[model samples]
Target: MIRKTLALLLLGLFAAPLWAADCSTTIEGNDAMQFNQKTIQVPKACKQFTVTLTHTGKLPKASMGHNWVLGTAADEPGIIADGMKAGADQNYVKPGDTRVITHSKLVGSGESDTVTVPVAKLKAGENYAYFCTFPGHAALMKGTLTLAP
Candidate 1:
């Protein structure tokens, strides 16, 4: 009975993780003004999704700061436009912007930040996009996101 119980415990432990969905992802930014990934998918089973952005460059925030911003594809332009106006102090994101679903704080070399997105805010067929809000960074550093059914 003892051996059977131990075996069952181990099996439960191993199987528990397999039954859960992956609800988080990591994205890396470099001094080259680029992101390691160009797309993300949020599992519908997840109540919330997390995104972690890591700056792998050697520059300071003033020069090559990076941030992750999420919004509808149609809102990308307006978000980027106003984010530039909002400046670095605001993580380059407009304050209290309802159009934004979620965003990570600005990060510099060797720094990192995370943002949580509520899955309820996402729809299956809507077009979503993420990008860096540092001035012209969005022109090159951007990606698409989708809610996976």
Candidate 2:
């Protein structure tokens, strides 16, 4: 009975991390210029969080490229504008944008990328926004993100 109880305890211990994995999330982009999710929550308990962006469409990057960019909602417009100026070679992001908290590399259809954001930089009450910086894609590819209690 003791051995069985210990085995169960060990199993529970191993399963704890899986249950606590609210730190990572996946977002999908399609040819239609849409993101699968409109909102994302990052758990405060995590020291860092990861966002994986996947392009499910079949279009090539040049015609329909996508990238995940994170910043405060207020900073989005300026960032997007600057990103546009930076153009495609820079993944539609300014080369040294301090406003960008984290961003993934530009990706094409059937491709994916991940960006890691440090939790310490996130404020609980601030409104955070995430979007694809592919030229004019921001209008249809934006989403909100928040820090969870």
Candidate 3:
């Protein structure tokens, strides 16, 4: 009985992390203006999803800043345009932009930021996108995000 109990405890310990590992993700951005992930799927069981952005490059924010921005796919072009006009002071995101679902703060090398996306804002079968709004970075730093059924 003791041996069985020990096996169960060990199994539980190893399984804990996997069981607790839903609804959040970490994505890395490098100096080459690329994101490590191309897609993210939010589980329908979650009330909110979190995305953490890490800048793995060695540059400063002024030269290679990165931020994660989320919005509907339809809003991407307009958002990127407005963000470019908004510039660095606003983290490249327009102020009071209703199209934005959520976004993280700008991060430089060795820095990180997190954003929480309310799952209620997402709908099944709807197209969603996440991208970096740092000037021309969006061209190479964009990805698709979806609500998983």
Residue-wise C-alpha lDDT for candidate 2, range 60-149, written one tens digit per residue:
999999999999999999999999999999999999899999999999999999889999999999999999999889999999999998
RMSD of each: 1.4, 1.7, 2.2
What does candidate 2 score on TM? 0.92
Evaluate model 2: give its lDDT. 0.95
Per-residue lDDT tens digits of candidate 3, residues 8-111? 99999998977663999999999999999999999998998989999999999899999999999999999999988998999999999999999888899999
Which number leads on lDDT?
Answer: 1
Model 1 TM: 0.93
Q: Estimate each model's TM-score.
A: 0.93, 0.92, 0.88
Clashes of each: 0, 0, 0
lDDT of 1 by residue, 1-149 (tens): 99999999999999999999899999999999999999998989999999999999999889999999999999999999999999999999999999999999999999999889999999999999999999989999999999998
Cα displacement (Å) at residue 3, model 1? 5.4
Higher-scoring candidate on lDDT, 1 or 3: 1
All models: lDDT?
A: 0.96, 0.95, 0.94
